[model samples]
Target: MSAPLRLILFDVDGTLVDSQATIFAAMRAAFSAAGLETPTRPALLSGVGLSLPVLMKMLVPEADERTQDQLVTGYKEAYHDLRLTQGAAHSPLYPGARGLLEQLSETPDVLLGVATGKSKRGLDQLIEAHGLERMFVTRQVADHHPSKPHPSMIDTARSEIGASQGDTVMIGDTSFDMQMAEAAGVAGIGVTWGYHPRDALGSAQHMVEDFAQLAGVLNKFWTVDHE
Candidate 1:
């Protein structure tokens, strides 16, 4: 018999929400203030599905830990401050984020949680304002566990959903997500709607071009282990 899916861990920024413009704007501001090269929009995107510290270390590598700290502090403060009012304003949910969440919620056997690179505070605030808190059983953010490409966060979310490694799936838009799922020995699906382009999701087992395709894909993928 195939393993059954009991949990689905999703990435926050790129997968469920469209915060690219806000992220890019805040990143540019922080980089400029730190006297680092302001990343282009595309370059900024490379950070979306990854960890904050990882992104900071890559973009502002010339900085020492203290400088990196300042940049992070600045970035978070700016993003949080500006984003509170703009919550999903500058960034909207991808086409079917709400519908997908609702559909998944209706499944008594399926549990949902967010495994994202966002800070816990950031996730809480954003989810609350965006009306997404009810859809997830748990919210695992960047610093809450080791960042992506690491399975700790995924593992943690699975635990929250009462799912074992054999019965959970990871959904994201980047190689980091795919790598994490692969490392955890679970299935991973990469979505094209997120920051990483389709080509960037090299390690994913499945890929979808839009939100509408998600439900059908998931319904099928969810049962792959059951057969």
Candidate 2:
């Protein structure tokens, strides 16, 4: 709580937004097209942070890399063409989401940014629509860098924000996010409003239930100096 966090990287889908219905619809459609059984939303939701390749593996056990690539491509196409719009048609921003981002933005020393697994195009669309583009200094997404459980995105976020690992915190709804933050040497802040639960955020220094607590935790973890 006394680390003086300077940069806070937030995951989009689960942490900041709730696109579960849309994501499930997309995954259901994707799996159906792939000749696989569509999983229940609860099953697919928990695996949200994994890369497409990994997703394909889960969906189709015998899937090879080439097939995985094709399946992922198909999934993205489907998601882009149909599900994303349907999902964002009615947003799922958790309580106090806007207030917290607004607060973070108002704090000049705070370098607000998006570190998500969504593609840059997808991230841009959501951020622009939500009026968050201006609030965020940078948006690091999937395909632009390696996936979670690898620290590339988190590392890139820190570098883009000119932040030291000691001054950074990665907040997300997935265990992979925790792993990524741990690998990047940053505090992993887990949110219960996201995909995974408290038990999954094993490496997280703190797990918060909502944005009210999120703000307080950030204050405790970060010093006003911005490190």
Candidate 3:
């Protein structure tokens, strides 16, 4: 008999690509364009996994909805322009990222998916740039979901992949990803190389320091018999 299906969901920014430089630059440009004070690096980095609108609100809590919308629009434009100028190489994958994905893709009964705060266009650009268009089976982006820490993205991915919560795992760099996994009743695995600090990822069932250690951590989950 075939092995039970295993759904592995990934988060994009801090989890996959180290887009810190690109993100920070674009955020500064956005605030400058909007005639507002640029947020500190720490403040900006802290909000990495949230949707644009929600992120703007966190950065400038006193701003009205209209101002927040304007900031979000400005940020998107700046980020897109920067991406065009720098190309995909500007955002490098963390060490062992591609190899880990390749290994997971080759595993039997394993399916890969992405649940990211990035927009669909952004996600597609990153995937295509890295020649990973065929890797992920399902792509869930912030364009459709409410935001991170919400279970909607994970729930949708699980449903589309037809994998029970017990057979799925969420791997990411932030507490938002861990919380989302918990809400979906799936295993949450945190990576230390991402944006959020290790202490913030307390919700994760397992935490690995690097991508090389991820396979072993995940193997424990995949080998379990949920039936």
Scored by TM-score, the top model is 3
TM-score of 2: 0.90
Candidate 3 per-residue lDDT over residues 1-227, each given as its tens digit: 87768899999999989999999989988888889999999899899999999999999999899888888998899889888888876688888999999999998889999999999999999898899988999999999999989999999998898998888999999999999999989999999998999999999999999887898888866665342
Question: In model 1, where do residues sit more than 4 Å from their true spots?
Answer: 1-5
Ranking by TM-score: 3, 1, 2
* Predictions in order: lDDT: 0.82, 0.80, 0.91
Cα lDDT, model 2, residue 26: 71
Off by over 4 Å in 2: 1-5, 83-87, 224-227
Cα displacement (Å) at residue 144, model 1: 1.6
Put down candidate 2 lDDT per residue, 11-73, tens digits, no spaces: 888889887877777777777777767777767877788777776677667767776677787
TM-score of each: 0.93, 0.90, 0.97
lDDT of 1 by residue, 1-227 (tens): 64344888898788888888888888877877888778788777887766777888877677799878878877888798778767658567888889989989888778888888888888888887878878888788887777788898887777666687767888998888989999988889999888888897888988998888878888887556456
Candidate of highest lDDT: 3
Q: Which ten residues in a row have the lowest lDDT in candidate 2?
A: 83-92
